[model samples]
Target: MMISLSRACVLTAACTVVLTACGGSTGTGGSATPTSSVDVGKASAVTPLDSATIARAEKQGSVLLYTNADAEQMAPVTKAFEAKYSAIDVRVLNMTDPQTFQRYATETATGVRTADVVMATDAVGMLNFVSKGNVLDYSDPNLKNLPDYARLAPGVVAMSEDPVVAVYNTALIPKDKQPKDLKSLAELSKSIKGKVGTTDITNPMSFGSVSNYTAKHGDAGWKNLEVLGQNSGVESGNGNLMQKLAQGQYQAAYFVAGSVRALIEGEEAAKVLNYTYLTDGTPMLPRAVAVTKKASSPDAAKVFVNFLLSAEGQEAACAGGFTPYRDGVECAYGLPAVEAVVGADNMMLGGYLEGIVKNKPEIVTRWKSAYDR
Candidate 1:
């Protein structure tokens, strides 16, 4: 059974594919080494990050948010925030997961950052900071009402409903070609051998679902991956995947909710690719949020992360196609059931990702070489 993300599992807000050989070993438990000379924890700054800091940082009302979300969705979210706190100036900078992490780590070490809120699904970063005590333990009042999966201790939290979703260029693949279930999808892989594309281990989290699926179904679950591994066109990130799909460079791609929704809604991509929800099952969460160390607007950041995990955020997630990690979030968007596949009692989806970092590569590599044979 897929573990229930709420209650017990340590939730990760973002997944990164572009990895560096940082001090820590790579895996679910590995953390980024402290490369800076100063102790980030005791290193005090000007003052506490409270309303006063927010007011000052606002410059009467200006705040910058660094996000991995596509511009279209973020634009409106930014506008909503500005409308609520007119004194807050919000500027959002978009980057891939890798760029986002590198920039944050650099900025944190340098003692300067443009990001008031660092939003992402990169769990490695979230865990790195949270475990190292880089995060502030401030909790939002509304947080208690949130579902369990959305909780990432008292610190990092995901504020958006970014689910990893499957997408197809409507112009290229026929509807009949799409898999109706995880089992069927694996079977279908044999038919369309070279037409699929996805991220690799470098992506760790997003494609980690493959490993998660394997744990549940054993060899049966991995059958689908045997097909994915054989694909002729594999990419490192979802943004690239969407762009390629938009241009008709590839017929189908698995995606995070942000990239899919961002592109499909933008005038640039809506004309080309359509998100095809796998009748096979809902994809694992492809996105999440984390508070950076030395943030300029810690309270507001706390508020924002809390909002994403609240009932409001989870419902919004269900409506948008991303599964809500928090509890009581019914998939009211007429979306498919993202019910746990492994067992009914389980609540989290992170183990499979960890498993991949630990074991799946050998299997995937052997599986990949089979096509050559």
Candidate 2:
């Protein structure tokens, strides 16, 4: 569930609507990009998406995408998808998760239907759409092929497996000294107080950060995050957080795993960076997509969703450096295998996330006070 940034060009002729969106990408799959052609340091970097299916996807008329994955990386695939489905179009509005959800919720609430498709990091956000009757329900004929976990919503499905990875400047910390788990990350926060980078506590971090928050110190886990923030010495919006980490501005950043890997090997950060998983908060986020409840082209939308979950599309996504959400599309990129298939994939945090809507004032109040500390 990575790689969502894109230029206006990323939005194909399919839709006139413009909105912000975010998703993630890592370990080469249907994408072939180092985002701007900057020389990533590794020769064996993550695989790009499968060239064949991507070639087909580019031709599928115009499909608007709201994701966190890199738009630059998606450009080739977008071009290819449009080419294959000449009648279709593809557009990726690349905005941060917060901005994406904000705009989507705002527009959808006001009866301003702007997006036809969304590939988002927060399944909870998707639930927002579904609950509001903004999302359409149409079980893809291909749903039978997916394991139950992939079929999260009545109509929605997972597109990728993206770990919320923590990255650091390898040059700053020796590999032997790198934190291997969340416990170590907390310790490292103390050990290198000024070197750590964190998401703005007032803003909340990645979905994975939710797990980190709870696992941190119980009901007062958010309080521990404040401590971590103090040690962080730097706070930025989640979207730009990783780019700064890639630039070595900070020793470590908490962001999606696959995106950081591209930066680790794609630029000057390579020689100095390393990433690891937290032993406790281990599961990755799932980026998902679904048709609009008011879809002008329901059939086309279903076709696109089916394409995304297909073996070809899933594998291409995997090759493009992101994990495929469908069953059995494994990669050689060293990502952990899908263990004990999760029963019903759910990424959108439940009622807790309602703060973004229902209790924004209080949520913002608490968040600001935390950062103010």
- The estimated TM-scores of all candidates read 0.66, 0.68
In terms of TM-score, the best-performing candidate is 2
TM-score of 1: 0.66
Provide the global lDDT of candidate 1 against the true structure: 0.48
Stretches of model 1 off by over 4 angstroms after superposition = 1-61, 243-249, 255-272, 307-373
How would you encode candidate 2's per-residue C-alpha lDDT over 1-373 as one tens digit per residue? 3343222221221022221221122222211123322221222112233455445544444566666667665564566555546777776787655566667778767877556676666555567667877678867666665546666676677766565556665556555566644556666687777677755433333444554335334556555555565577545553455544544556676544444444444333334445655434444555677787655445556666766766666556755556654434454332324222111231221212223445434444554565464
Q: How many residue pairs clash in each candidate?
A: 34, 78
Candidate no. 2 TM-score: 0.68
The alpha-carbon lDDT assigned to residue 118 of candidate 2 equals: 68
**Scored by CA lDDT, what does every candidate get?**
0.48, 0.52
Candidate 1 residue-wise lDDT, 1-373, digit = tens:
1111121111111111111211221111111111123221221111223565455544534455676654544555555555656766667787766677668778877877656666656555555546666566655555555434545545655453333456655456544455434455445555666666666544644444554455556676565666666753666665455555545566666533423443343332333444543434344543556555677776566545554555555455444334444544454221123332212222234411443334655755654453343
